[model samples]
Target: MERGNRRNALWLKQVIVLDSSLLIAFKIKNDSHHERANALMKQVVSERFGKPSITSYIFDETVTGIFVKSKSLRLAVEYGNELLASLETLEVSEEAFREAWKIFSEQRNRRLSFTDSSTLAVMKIHDIGRIATFDEDFGNIEGINAIGLV
Candidate 1:
């Protein structure tokens, strides 16, 4: 592909809504996918993927992961703060909660975490179809596309 075509392809993909797992992977240096995740982040931020946003659930998860998984609490806090500063925080609204509740209740065979559903709800509200997530569960959903695993 031509260089312009490649750039256009990447830009036309979709907005990226980052899940906790992917954000944690980017935050914690030890994460196996850190390099790839970091490269993705660099491109997304520099190129501008319709302004990235992370649900509050994901923000909490990142901080908790750092505290629980990292070797040093101080280091974890440092990185956690850095990550928090960078993200656009999205609060879970009543409508989002209701939507998530409906999605979970309708899916008898699958279990969706309230947090995960909330993230999906945000994407739905914002008209975002793409997400950065390590979990494969999002792919099972009809409208949203999980870009990280792909």
Candidate 2:
């Protein structure tokens, strides 16, 4: 196979966990990561890559974060609903929350948010290796790699 085709095939085998930072960047026009997030969206829509997934907690975080940062409940609700309707949202069980809480409690030095902890928990559960995010913290993680830079 040609190099470009090989890259596309590899991309097809990957599943990316959608992080709040990328979603927020796409939802808000003025966000620093907007352009890169837009490019990622194009890839998703073009189906050149694997479908994206997000945990229920990440969904909540993205929606709430959008509202908090944008100060517009309408945009938040609209984007939240759109994501729920479109994306493959992973569930957050008690076990998952417990795992996330454990990580949050233990990672005092990392300052990882409970929401980010939930993302980690969900990604581990689903065996996902890549995260669509602008945050550098994901880069510090063991199993997961972050994509979609600012």
What digit string (tens of lDDT, one per residue) describes model 1 on residues 1-150? 999977755543445778877777887788888887888788668745555667787777777877787767896788767767876677778888898787766766666777787788777775677777777778767777776675
Query: Could you estimate the TM-score for every candidate?
Result: 0.77, 0.82
Deviation (Å) of 6 in candidate 2: 26
Residue pairs clashing, model 2:
none
Worst 10 residues of 2 by lDDT: 6-15
Q: What lDDT tens digits, residue by residue, belong to model 2 across residues 59-101?
A: 9989998999899999889998999898888788888899899
lDDT of each: 0.74, 0.81
Candidate maximizing TM-score: 2
Off by over 4 Å in 2: 1-14
Q: Which candidate's lDDT is highest? A: 2
Q: Which stretches of candidate 1 lie over 4 Å from their true place?
A: 1-15
| Candidate 1 TM-score over all chains jointly | 0.77
